[model samples]
Target: MLSDKERDQVRQTIEQQIAEAEKEMVVLKELTAAVAPDNSIGRISRMDAINNKSVNDAAYRNTRTRLKRLQNVLEKVDDKDYGLCMRCGKPIAFGRILILPEKRVCVSCSK
Candidate 1:
């Protein structure tokens, strides 16, 4: 269980993370834009560009998922079970929660 102060801290941290993730999503969306087929680049360079786009697309997806999880965690910040590990039903360490408020599992169960 977490005190009210700890919960507030986690809420603030999660909100900040959410804002950062949203900004990153916008940048990644630009990076993942379709590569023009008729570009004046060499074949190898075009291939490299395509590959980079694929990587950026994956990163964008991952960030989007994390953003959604953070939103969910923010909503649950005031709940009684907010800091409890989902795997073992133990209270997560306050330090760990401060660092990763979106995580639902503790260090022990995460292994």
Candidate 2:
């Protein structure tokens, strides 16, 4: 079992990461909405509409993936299993958190 202080540290780290991810997702959503064909101005053409739709689809998929990852991390936090190597059930190194805020496996177990 982890000490109280250690658990708190991990919680705080995850909280910060979650906040940043939410902020980024919000910005991405806003940007995507701005570029949506329905909201855009100027002359419209078939090719231009197709191109916009393609870009919108790509961006939406990317943002949704990121959001899902963030939500998964949050669920891990709720389960009190954050910061553990998912593969080996070992404690993940603190330094690894900086590189991968929501990593499920540590360097060794990830290999």
Candidate 3:
């Protein structure tokens, strides 16, 4: 269980992370845009650009997933079991929750 103050702190941290993730998603969206086939770039350069776009597309998807998880966590912040690990039913460390509010399990269970 977490104290009121601790829960509040976790909520704020999660909110900050959400904002940062949203910003990163926007940047990644631009980076993942389709490479134009009609461009004058050499074959090798075009292939490299396509590869980079694929990487960025993966990153964008990951960021979007994280954003959704954070939003769900935000909604559960006031729940009595908010800080409890879903796997072990133990209270997750305050620092761990603050750093990764989207996680529903503790470090040990995550292994």
Candidate 4:
């Protein structure tokens, strides 16, 4: 279990990540919108736009998923078992949480 100060720090970090993910999602939305199908461009340019849109769509999905996971972690930050490994019922290391705030299992249990 983490101390109150540590939990606060984690919360702040997750909040910052949420803000960044939201920003990225907005940018991805704009990028995908700009690549909308149009007859004004050549076939090759249209193909490139299609490719870029696909990539941007995947990135947008990933960013949304990340944002949801982070939000879930933020909700659980004050829980008694917030940092406990769900598989092993052990305390997850602070370092692991620092690097992967959405982690629910410890390294040993994850393997």
Q: What is the model-wide C-alpha lDDT for candidate 1?
A: 0.92
All candidates' lDDT scores?
A: 0.92, 0.66, 0.93, 0.91
Model 4 root-mean-square deviation: 1.6
Clashing pairs in 3: none
Kindly give the number of clashing pairs for every candidate: 0, 0, 0, 0
Q: How close is candidate 4 to the true structure, as a TM-score?
A: 0.89
Looking at model 2, residue 4 earns an lDDT score of 60
Better of 1 and 2 by TM-score: 1
Per-residue accuracy of model 1 over 10-100 as CA lDDT, tens digit each: 9899999999999999999999999989668979999999999999999999999999999988999999988999999999998899888
Candidate 4: C-alpha lDDT:
0.91
Candidate 4 residue runs with Cα over 4 Å from true position: none
Please say which candidate is ahead in TM-score: 3 or 4.
3
Which pairs clash in the backbone of model 2? Answer: none
lDDT of 4 by residue, 1-111 (tens): 789999998899899989999999989999988665678897899999899999999999999999999999999999999889989889999988877888899999888
lDDT of 3 at 85: 95
Best by TM-score: 3
Return the candidate ranking by TM-score, descending: 3, 1, 4, 2
Per-model TM-score on C-alpha atoms: 0.94, 0.58, 0.96, 0.89
